[model samples]
Structures are given as structure tokens and as C-alpha cells.
Target: MTSTKTSLLGLTRAELESFAVALGEPSYRGRQLYLWIYGRRARSFEEMTDLPEPLRRRLDAAASLDRLSLVRDTTAPDGARKLLLEMSDGLRIESVYLPDSPGNTVCISSQVGCALGCAFCATGKMGFYRNLTAGEIVDQVIEVERLTGARLTNVVLMGMGEPLHNYDNVVKALHLLSDPKGIAISRSRITVSTVGITPMIERWCSDDPPAKLAISLHATTDERRASIMPVARAYPLDDLMKSLRRLAHVTRYHVTFEYIMIAGLNDRREDATNLKTLLRNIPVKVNLIRLHPTGSDLQPSSDNAIARFLDWLRQEGIRCTLRESRGVENSAACGMLFAQEPIRPSSTQRRTLDTDD
Candidate 1:
């Protein structure tokens, strides 16, 4: 089988220029191609009208512009759309486009499946398939833009896999998405969510990338967190807090803690107080997410419970917001994205085993 060449969509401007020059095309061709791919949202080489047919053929021969195939699309009653995208390798992932006041927000997946076994996540049940290439990640946005006819103002890496687990590709995708000559979305508008992988967090803080950071911190205490999320055992709350402190000191942006309200689990006033203490000195905002029913062992916390928790936080002067669950009818809720088909086995395959929780 002939493998497709590297895509131009994932390349930096310098890299794109190098590729164009190597192809015997002028340097300016890179900018034109970039605009064609991103600005015009062209899917085929034929859409690049200004380029000569021979050059277009050369480009087609050299690299593939295609990355994802839209396998299924479902629109929620609330107007949210979820897409199940099949990669070239036959691995499946999901992306969601949600309408907001000013613009739309696209929630993109970074991997085929998830490695972090968060108790309440349906995608976690699917297990880790593979990390998405930068081109595949960028393609999700391009496809969403095509469907909606509006530029994506906000991007959240809170889909199928842990963004920190697939750090390199996720970073590459961010650079591609935020490139001025490409999508040009502000880094401030992009948020990368992680399950608190300590080393990567430390590295990210030290390197200081422009995008915002969000930690999936369902519990404040290590023991309780470990009970719900297996990742907590690897990177305990104390260690996670140390890394968060470094991130706070270095970056001006406020880190958001995603606290999923699971009914009869971690919904007490004491839990809220513990959360306040945990984030006491750190520059942070709390996003209270009501658990979406995934037919899992966990149940959603009641609205009254969520209100009580928010009331406590507000009274304590912590910046907090109750995030409304969108696309619940479409299985686009937090940690719910997974392809319906089976993944093809590979030599380097990693399986996701079922957990009791």
C-alpha cells in the first residue's frame, strides 16, 4: 500500500516554505497554499485555482491533504453537533461543535481513545487506541468550520484522550491551530485539559506555552481522587499541586479546575471547603460540571447539590462557574466521545481494561 506523504496543514510557515522551495515552487507559494488550506478551507488541491495543474499534481504526489473521514454526524436538540471521524488508519475519534453567544466552540479529541481511567467516562471504557497526528487534529477544526460556516473561537482539548498523555502531538496541533498564517486562533482561546500528568505539567510550565491549562481535578484529597481516577495514584494531589503552583507563579492565566459533580460522591460542603483549601493560593477558577449519565456506575449530582457547592465557593470568594451540560442527547458530554466500531489491532496496541468503579 502506498502511504500518503506528510500533510502541509501541520507544517509551520518556515517548514511550509521549505517544502514549497523543495518542490521547485517559489517561496510565496507557501503562503498561498496556507491560505488555500486554512483561509479558504479547501479540501482538494483542485480548489487552489491559481496554482498550475503540474504543481498541483506534484503537491498531490508529495503529500496528502486528507486526514479524517466523517463516519457519522449527530446534531443534538440543543443545536450541538457531534462528529465521529475515522482516521486513515481506521481508528475512530470524536469532535463536538457547540454554539455560544459570540461564536462557536469546537471540542476536539487528541487520541483515538483514552488511557486515563476516569471512573465516570464512557471513552475511558474504549481504552487507548492511538495518538492523533497533528494533521488529523487540525482537520477536526477545518471540518467543523465547513459544517457551521463560522470560525471556531474557542477550542477545548477535553475529548477522547488526555491531552497531556499525547503531549508532543497535542503541542504540534496547537502550534498549527494558533499559527497566524493558518487558523490564527489566539492561544488564549485554546484550552488544553489534562488528568494532571505532573512531569508534563512541570515541563509545560517551564516552557510556558501560550494556551490555557485545565486540570481534571474531581477530588481535592489524594485518597478520594485516587478512588475515582487511577491517574491520581501515579501523580498524587500533592505532587500535582506543586506543579500547579509553579504554573501559577510563571503564567498570568488562571488555571481552571474541572470538578465533575458525581451524585453521593464528593458533593458535600466539606468537599467544597477542601477544594477551596486545595486551590487557596493558586490562581485558579473552578468549573463545576454535572456528571452526564453514561450508564456508568457513577450518577449525576442533583441541581440542588450543585447549587449548594457553588454557593459555598461563592461565599468563600472563589471564582467559580457551573458549566451547563450540552449535547447530552448526542453523547457529546465530558468523557463520552468514542467510536462505535472496533479498532484494528496493531503491534504497539495498548488496551483499555474495565474498572470496577
Candidate 2:
């Protein structure tokens, strides 16, 4: 059964101090907790050796350090590890670890599934289940560190859900993750990807965003973007660009537009020119991603098509990069995270954390 006790995983240091004060302990105890839970990576109160035995016992009874149970773990040949984690209520989410050069990066989810039915994303096919708590979000980082034994130098909220849909919790988790007393990841190293939620983009810009922004711009025209991403229909491309222009002006970071190149769909030279016109005055970078298969009839752009597209953008003086697909063999690459087979809803409600069908 899920514990009724309070969970201290996502609490900020000030909140932790308040919790300690409420428990009749000095506020310093909370600061110590900040050290242990994040820095020392303590999983249980018993591991907090510096705390008093009686206080630890009291904490054990009144609080819980609940963790997502690892339901299934897969490692790609490229040393990328994908974890399907089961929450207290049995919902599952995927988090991935990519051991990149210069730094290690962890990609985490903000919600169980997704509501934005993006045609290329496997997670969106599952539909929206629920938003993950701030604790659940932060714990993905903690759990990844424990499982991989690698310090994550970068974080991306690009796993399963559109982070702006779960704005408050995502913002809280961002602060906690970048807090000096906590995981201490640099805000500049963190990026949040969205499928163009315009109002939320404005709100994020106004609130002094902690992480960088990446918006999915698979197609240059509104009609084409709406054809693939249903959310695009709600917020038109023109309005989205206006907000992005403002965001680019206000934020210190350059906006990144993620374009998925699909065969015979949006990879033509004309599309590249249209994209250039669309992002004319915006300070931005383009990341061209070859579409990864997810049971869709759509095929990836040909090598020559991608090269031409990249060459055209570079020739136009736009900063662009072609993202190399990693973890493709194990279904852990971009747009490939789903929890269908990993979660088993049976009479016993038991699930294994090993590789299985």
C-alpha cells in the first residue's frame, strides 16, 4: 500500500527546514537533511547516521522516502540505459541515461503519459494518465544516479509529457534539481522541450525560467504542424512564433527548434526555406532529428535529404545541428518511450524489473 506519511523527496531546503521545525527539531536538522538526501543520496532514514537515533525513529514513523520501483530496465548498445519506473499507484514512466562525451545526461518525464497526441511520439499514443508530483519528478534524478553510478551533468524534460502541461510541478522540480544544496545541476545545462504550448511559453519567460527551452517544430506551416501535432491546431503557428520571439528577446538562452525530418513529408528544400522565413528575426538554433520509428507508417528522411536540409540552413546563416540518434536498437531513442509491455495489470499486480516480453 502507498504510504500515508509525508514524503520529503521534493521539498526545498526552506520547506525541509519548516518540516523540521514542525517536528520539534531545530531547523538545522533540515539543512542536514538537505545534505544527506541530495548530496549523500540517502534512500532511507536509517542511512542518515548523523541524525539522532530517536529523531530518526520519529522520522521513520511520520515520514516516508517513497521511491518508484524499477519495473523494467534496458541498456542500449551505446551505453544508454532506459528505466521503466512504477509509481505507488502502479502508473509507470520512463527515464533514460545517456553517457555522452564531456558530460552525462538524464532525460526525465513530467507526466505518466501525454495528452498532446503528437503523431510521432510513442508516449502520446498512450493518452494522458496523470501528472507526476514534484517528488516523483526529482526522484527520477536521484534514482538514475543510484542505478547508473554516474553523476548527471545535464537534464532534459523531454521524456514522456509536455512539461508546460504540468507547469507548477515542473517548475518546482527545476528549482530543486538546480538548488545548490540539492542535485546542483547547472540551470544552463537543463532544457525543457514542449510541443509549442504558447501561453505557457509566455508564462515561463515572464517567470524567469530556470532551464532552456526547446519547441517541436517538425513542419514549417501550421497546416502541416497541425496534421502531426494536434496541439498545433489549438495554438496557431503565427501566434507561437510571436511568443517565441518575445521569449528569445527576454531570456538569456537561445531558443531551440526541434525539427523531425520525415520522408516525403517535410524534408524538401522548399520546407527548409519556409522554416528560415518563419524563424527570421528569432534568435534560435535548429536541431534536425531523423524520425525514429514508433509503429507509424511514416519513414525517416533519406541521408541525402537530411544533408541538403542541413546544408541549406547553414548556407542561410542559421546555426543548426543534426542530432545523432542514440539507443535506437533498444527503443530508447527519441520518440520511443512507452510503458505498455513493461506494466502488467494482473490479479497479483506484480511486475518484474528485468528484460522480458
Candidate 3:
């Protein structure tokens, strides 16, 4: 298996320049190659027509550029499209492109499967597989651009796995996504969500952080949260809130809280009140997501229940929005991204790696 370090597509402009100089090519060659892959969105070396044939041959021989392949694509009635991407290693992941009034938004996955074990999520049930390389993540966005012929304005790292778990690669992907020479998408257009990984959040706030942060805050009470997301057992509500406070204070961005309304679970009026009390001092917006049926024990909150919950939050003066479910018919809604292929465990199973580095 060749490592990504040998791949040219994933390299930053500076890294590409260094590689080109090491190969005794002019510095301009690296910039040309960067523009070819990112600006021109070329897939194969042959497509880089501006580069001389000899240089293209040298580049191809030194490093391979091919990364992700679009295995399947499904469009929703609402015009949302979901893609099943097969990585070079044959590991599968999902990415979604949603058409909004402003522009299209692409939801990219950071890991193959999830290890968080959130009870309501289907990806969690699939177990952790492998972390996706930065190239793989960037390739999904490029593929979407190629298909739509329109620039993707917004990106949300809320797909199969928790992005904060795959911190380094996720951050690298963000940098590549926001690079001025490439996609040049503003950091504000990218939103990275996590299931409250405190240490990583703290580091992200202190270090170079992305534009927005969203926490998967399903429950207000620690006990209730622990029952649903196993991650809560490690970082409880109080601890998580402290970290969130630091993030908000440092970044000055109102964090978004994602609350999935499960019927007979956390949809009660009292739950709304508890949520308000819990988020009283934090700068936050609550996104109430209607639970998409994943054929699990969980059920979607009734329309009445969701309306009542939203009304309660409004009465309490909390900013809340009820997110409309998209692509439910295609299993592309929240908590529904898992490979449809049969799981065939390898003879030697790789140890599951934590995404929280």
C-alpha cells in the first residue's frame, strides 16, 4: 500500500514546490501543477495539457494523483444528491451535496466509520474503520464541483464520522479547502461539528481553528446525555460546557448546538426548558433536527411534538431553528450514512484508532 506522502494531489502548494525543486524542475512547475489539479480540476496527468509531456510523465512517475472514485450517486426529490465514494484502499464513505437558496453545500466525511457509538446513529453501529486522508476529503469536494459545474459555497463536516475525532486530517482538509489558491472558500463557510471532544475543542480554540464549531448537544443533563452518546461518559455536560465556553470566548463565534428530537426520548416540553437553562449563558444557536428513522429503536418526534418544542424554546428566548429533513428516501438524512456493502472483516482486524488526537 503506497502512503499519501507520495501522492501529489494532496500536497500544499509549498510542499509541491519543494517536491518539484527536489525533482530538479523549475519552481513555476509546482504552481502550474497545483493550478492544474485544483484550479483546472484535472483528474489525470494527461489532462494537464499546459505542462510539457516530459514533465507530466515525471510527475506521474514520482507520485500518483488518483484518490477517490464516485461509486454511486442518488438524487433526492428535493434535488439533494448523496455520493458513495470508494477510497484507494477500497474503504467506502459517504458525501452529500445539498442545494440551498444561496448556493450548494457539501457535507464531507472525515472517517470511514464512527467509533462514537451514539445510540441513535447508524454509522456508530458500523464501528470505526479508518481515517480518511486529506486528499480523500478534498477529492469529494472537487468531484462535487466537477459534477455541478458550480462552486460549493458551504461545507459541513457532519457526515459518517465525528470530525473532531479525526482532528489533524480534518484540519488539513479544512486548510486545503480554504486555501486562497484553490477553492478559496471562506473559513466562515465551513462548519465543523463534534460530539463534545473537550481536549480537541480546547486545542482547536487555542490553535488555528476553523470558522464555526457545532456541538452535537442532544441532551442537557449529563445523565441523559450519557445514556445516548457513549462519548458523554468521558466528557460530561458540565465539563463539555466549560470547554465550549472557552471556545466561544476565544473564537467569539456563537456555537451551534445540534439537537435531534427523538420521540419519547428528548422531545418533551420539560426537555426544552432544561435545554434553555443549560444554554442560558452560552452564545449558541439550537438546531432542532427531526430524527430520521434509521430502523433503530428510536422514532421521530411527531410534528406536534417538534412544533411544541420549538415554541417552548422561542418562549424562553433561545434562538432555535427546526431543520427540514432532506434525502430521507435515500437514507441521506442525519444519522443515516453507513456503507450498504456487506461487512467482511479482515483476517487481521486493525485496531480502531481514536479520532480525538
Q: Give the backbone clash total of model 1.
A: 0
Candidate 1 per-residue lDDT, tens place, 208-327, comes to 775899999998788888888987877878888888998988887888999999887788888888887888789889999988877678888888999998999988789999887788
Candidate 3 colliding pairs: 165-355
After superposition, the stretches of candidate 2 with alpha carbons farther than 4 Å from their true spots are 1-3, 342-357
Instruction: Report how far off residue 316 is in candidate 3 (Å).
Output: 1.3
Q: What is the lDDT of residue 265 in candidate 3?
A: 74
Which window of ten consecutive residues has the lowest lDDT sum in model 2? 348-357
Tens-digit per-residue lDDT, 131-159, candidate 2: 88998999999999999889999999999
Cα TM-score of candidate 3:
0.94
lDDT (CA) per prediction: 0.83, 0.87, 0.83
On residues 1-357, what C-alpha lDDT tens digit does candidate 3 reach at each position?
754436876778888888889989888888888888787788888899988899878777777887687788998898778888887777788888898835789988988888888888888877788788888888889988787676899988989888877788888888888887887778988998899888888889888655599999988788788888877878878778888888888888898999999887788888988887788678989999988877678778889999999999999899999987888888888888888865455614434655333
Q: Write down the TM-score of every candidate.
A: 0.93, 0.94, 0.94
Give me the displacement of residue 120 in model 3, in angstroms: 1.3
